[model samples]
Target: MTGIEAINVYCGLARLPVPALFAGRGLDPARLDHLMMTERSVGLPCEDPVSNAVNAARPVVDALSPEERDSIELLVTSSESGIDYSKSIASYVHAYLGLGRNCRVMEVKQACYAATGVLQLAAGYLASGVSPGARALVIATDVSMADARAGYAEPATGHGAAALLIGPDARVLELDPGAFGLYSYETLDSARPEPDRDIADVDASLFAYLDCLSRSFADYRSRVADADWHTTFTRLALHTPFAGLVKAGHRKLTRELTGAGPDAVAADFAERVAPSLHYPSRVGNLCSGSVYLALCSLIDHLPPGAPPQRIGLFSYGSGCASEFFSGLVGEGARQALAPARIGERLAARVPIGFDEYTDLLAGNSRCLLPVADRDIDLAPYERFLTADPGRGRLLVHRGTKNYHRTYEWV
Candidate 1:
C-alpha cells in the first residue's frame, strides 16, 4: 500500500482578479459572474514553470533530514512546460533541490494527465520491493497560457505546482494497489505547438472530458464490483478546468451511479466535493497540478476528529486520458497538511491590474535570448525573464548557434 507521506504546493506570486481581467475585454461581467462567480483569479506571468516547480518542491525537501533526503530514489516531474527539448526538467529540479545524485530522474507528458500517470508509476516502484525503505519525489508543475484568440479559456488559465513525497508510511491518503481504472484515446481537443500559445476546440474538449469521465468511472465500478460507490466514498477530487465543470462532472456522476435528480446531486456535491474546490476557485486552472491541488484542498478543509475518509480522484488530460482511483485517508491526514499555512501563502500574493497583465504576457520571451543583442533589458519586458547575477539560480538558453543551455549557481 504505497501512499503519500508529505505534500506541498506553490501558486504563482502574481495574480489578476477575474473582474479586472475581463473589464474591458467585451465580456459581459454579469454573465461571467453568474458562470464563474467573483472569487476567481488567474496566475500572472511572474515566474517560469521551472521556478514554480523548484519553489514548490523546496519545502518538502527542507522538511526532510539530510539522511531522508539521501533516501530519495526517484525524482519524476510531469509538465507540459518543459524548458528544453533534450533535457528533462527533473534534472534541473534535482540540481535545484540538491537531491541525492544516485536518484533516477525523468519527465513525463501526456497533456495534463502526466502527473497522475507518473504518480501511479512511482507508487508501483515503491511497492515492487526494489528499495525497501526508499522514497520517490513526484512533481506536477504547469503555467497555463492562452493566446488572445483563446477567448473563454484565457480567463480560465492558471499556473502553479504541487510536489508529493511518496512512501509506505501513508500519513496522508493510502492508495489501494489494485483499485484503479484508466481510459485513453487520440483526439485534437487541445494543443500547444508554440511555446507560449495554447489553443483548444472548446465544445469538442468539453464533450471529450465528460465522455472520459463516464468511461473511467464505469471501469472503476467494474473493477471494485462489491463496493457501494455512492455511500462508500465520502469525498471526490475531480480535475478542474473551471469550477462549474467540476460541479457538472459531479452531477453527471451522481446521475449515472444512483439515478439521482438534480436536487440530490447538488446536495451530494455540496457535502462531498465543494470543500475541495477552494484552490481551484481561487487559482483557475493548474494544468497538471489541478487534481492534486484539489486533494490538498480536501485534506486541508476536513473537520476536526472527522472519521477516516475514502476519497475518489478523477484525473483528465487533454490529448485525452482519464483515470479514476480511490484512497483511504488516515487520522493523521489533517495534521499532516496544515491548511492554514497554505492559506497564508495564497493570501500573500500581489495582485496586478489587467494592463500590467497584458504587458507581461506580451513581453514573455520564453527564455529565448535575442540572437543579435545580448545586452537587451528584459526587466521591463518580463521580470521573470531577466537574469539576475546575484540570485543563485539562473537558466540561459543560447540559440541554435551554440545549441547549449547553461545552469549557473553563484
Candidate 2:
C-alpha cells in the first residue's frame, strides 16, 4: 500500500573469528550445548568492531559493479558501540566501500532494534523516489561482550558480523501492509553507562521485559479478534537478547492468546527449538542485529516445505521501545536467501584461544607509526585503504584491530 518497491536481503559473506575461550580461557566450545554458530568465525577478529564491519561489507561490495557501488544511497549501521562520540561510523563505511560523495549516511541507536529500524526506514525511502538508486545497505556487527566468563550473553559471547543489501526489486522480501506496532510506557529493562558498560544484568531482566511486551500483545490481539483472519504466521522471531528470552516471551504470549495451560505452553516453547535449528547461543546480544540473526538462523536451518512459516519479528530497545512485525516466507524465500552459501561460510571457521581473544580485544594503533594500506585481494573484489591523521582521517583496508574494533582509518 505504500508504493514501496522491494526489500532485498543480500547477506554479505564474511565472519568474525571466535575468541580463545577454548584454548587460553580454559573454556570449552563443546560445553555450549545450546548455542548458535555463524557461517564461520575467527577469535582475533572480535577485537575490532569496525574491521569486522569492513570485512563483512567487502564481499558484498565486490559482488556489485563500480557503477552499482557508486549508486548506493545510504549505509545505515546499527550498533550500541559508536566508533566516536561525534564521528559517525557511516562515513567510515562509505569511504571504505568506495561509495560516491552523494551517499547519505547515519547511525541508528536503539540497542538491537537499530538494524530493524533501518529496514523500516528503507521501506519509507522506497516509497519516495528522490534518490537515483532505491537501495539501502544495512550492516550489523558486534564483537563478544568484552568479558566472556560471566553473564548469559556468555557462550553467546563471540565475534560475528552480518550484512544485508536492501533495495526495491522483485527478488527480495516484500514489505506487507499493516505490519508494525510500537510498545510504549515500558521501563528500561537494561541500561549501562555509555563507556565501559557492564551488562552483567542485561539478560537477567529479559523475563520482566517480555512480560511488558506480552501485555501489549494481548491488547493488540484483543483488538484484532473481531476481524476474522484465516491466515497465520509460521514463526515468531524476537530481538533475542538471550536464547531463553525467546521461550519466556513465547510462553507468556501463547498462553494468553491460546488459553493453553502452563504445561501445554511450556511444551510449545520447547517445540520451537528444532534439532537442526541453531539459535544465537554464541554471539551474545548483538543489540540491533539479534532479530536479523534469528531470521538468518531459522532460514539457514529450517527444513524445506516448512509451510505456514510466517516470521514474527520482535524488537526491544531499553529506554525503552518494543515492536512486533511479521514477514511472509514466500515460495522463493529460501532460494533468494542463498542458504547453501551461508551454510558453507559458517562451517569453515577456525577457533582461537581466549588469551588471543583478549589480546585482540586490546587492539590499538601506534601514535608514531604511520597508517599503512592493507593489500586485500579477495576474489571478485578489490580492497584499498587510505589514512589521513592530518585531517584525523582513517582510511583503512584491514588496518588495525584495537579495542575490539577493525575500523579503517579513513
Candidate 3:
C-alpha cells in the first residue's frame, strides 16, 4: 500500500505557443506537425528551481492535516538545474515547506529518470515498516534553458515541477508490489555540461530512449509472470519529451509485442496512450516531471465513478537509465486530483508572444548562476503574477544575498 497518497503539478504562470516559437526562430513550419505539441511553459525571471519546487508542493502540503505534515520524514528534490554544487536543492525545499527537523532531506540527479528512481526508493522505505505511518515527499523541479539556439528543441522544452506525496494510504496511485524492471548504461546522448548549456545528439537520444524501453520491459517481464504488454495494464503513461515521441514509442512497442499494424496501433494508442499526452503536449517537457505529468493527464480522464485501473509507466533519462513499472489508480483518483486544477490553471497561464519570449530567454539562462549575490526583477512580469493570483499562494525567487537564495510568496 506504499505509493502516491497524492500528486500535483505547477507548470509556471506563462506559456509560449510552439508556432510562435518556430516562426520566431525561422524554423521550418512543417516541424510543428512532427512535434504534436501546442505550447511550452516559460519560467519567469522570478521563478527558479527552488521556487518551482516549493510552488508545486505547497498546495499538497497545505492540504495535509498538521499531523500528516509532521509525519513527512523524508523529502527528496530531483533536478539537473541545481543552483549550487554543494547545497542540495532539498535544503531550500525543506525550509520553505516547513518540514520537521528530524526529517531526512536530500536531492537526486540522473536526468529525467531521477524522480521515478527516488519515488520507488521512497515507496520502498514506506513499505519497509521501519518508520510506521511515515510519509515521503518527492519534487521533480527544473527550469528550461531553451532558446532559439536549441532550434526545434527550444519550443519543446518546459519549466516547473511535479510533487508526489507517498505513504501507506495510496489514495492516488498504488504501486504494484515488487513489479518493476530497470536498465542503465552510459552514453553521451545528452548532457548539460554547463549550467545554462544543453547539448543533445538527437539521433543518439532517440536511439537510447527506444533501446532503454525495450530492454527495461524485457527485465520487467522477467520479474512479473504473465505480464502481457497488451492486457496487463488498462492505460499507458511514458516519459514524454514530446507527444510524437510517445506515439512512436507506443507504435514500436505494440508492433514488437503484439505484431500490431498501423491501424491497430493507432486505435490502441488512442485508447491507452493518448490520454496521457494531454498535459505534456501543452507544457512541453518537465524533465523528470514529464512522465508524472503524463500520468496526471491520464488519471484526469477518469470519470466520476470509473473503476480502478492498472497503468503501465516507462521512464527514460539521458546518460542514461530507464525503468518499466506498473501501478493502480485508486477509484477516487479524479476526486483526489481535482484541487490541483491542472487544466484550469493551465488555461489561465498568460500567453506570451515571440518578442516577449526572446526577452525571457535572458532571464531563463541566468537561473542557475552561481553568483554570490543577485536580485531578480519581477517588475517586468507583474502581469503574469496578477493574472491569476487567486489560484493559490505562488512562490518566487526574490534574489540571492551572500550566497543564500531568497524567496517570497506572491
- Identify the candidate with maximal lDDT: 3
1-410: candidate 3 lDDT, tens digit per residue: 88999999999999989998888789999889889999989888899989999999999999999999999999999998988989999999999998988899999999999999999999998999999999999999999887666777788898999999999999889999899999999999887899998888888998999999988999999999999999999999999999998898989989999999899999999999999999999999999999999999999976578899999999999999999999999888998998899998998999999999888888888889787899887899899999996687888898899999999988
User: What does candidate 1 score on TM?
Assistant: 0.90
- Whole-model Cα lDDT per candidate? 0.76, 0.53, 0.92
lDDT of 2 by residue, 1-410 (tens): 23112222222222333333433445666643433333223334213445556556665666677877776677877776665666566667676777778777877776666677777777677557777465777777654434553443444543445566766552334555456656655455555443434354554356556855675454444544442111354555676665656766777677656778988776665555332135354344556666766676666555777653556567777766667665555556566566325444443333434554455443321111233433222221121111111212222334334422244333
Backbone collision count in every prediction? 0, 38, 0
Worst 10 residues of 2 by lDDT: 380-389
lDDT digits (tens) for residues 1-410 of candidate 1: 68989888877656677777678476767657434634343443335566678777887888889989998989999988876777787887898889999899999888878888888889998999889989999999877667468877777777778898999888888997878888899999998777767889988888888999888888887898765558868899998888788887888878987899888888898899998888877777778788988898888889889888899998999989999998998889989888426766666566677787777676443432223323324334244333222222333222233433333222
Off by over 4 Å in 3: none
TM-scores, in order shown?
Answer: 0.90, 0.73, 0.99
Give the total clashing residue pairs for model 3.
Answer: 0
Quote model 2's TM-score: 0.73
Tell me the spans in candidate 2 whose CA falls farther than 4 Å from its real position. 1-47, 65-71, 129-133, 148-150, 170-172, 185-188, 192-194, 202-204, 215-231, 262-279, 305-309, 353-410
Better of 2 and 3 by TM-score: 3
* TM-score of candidate 3 versus the correct structure, residues matched by position: 0.99
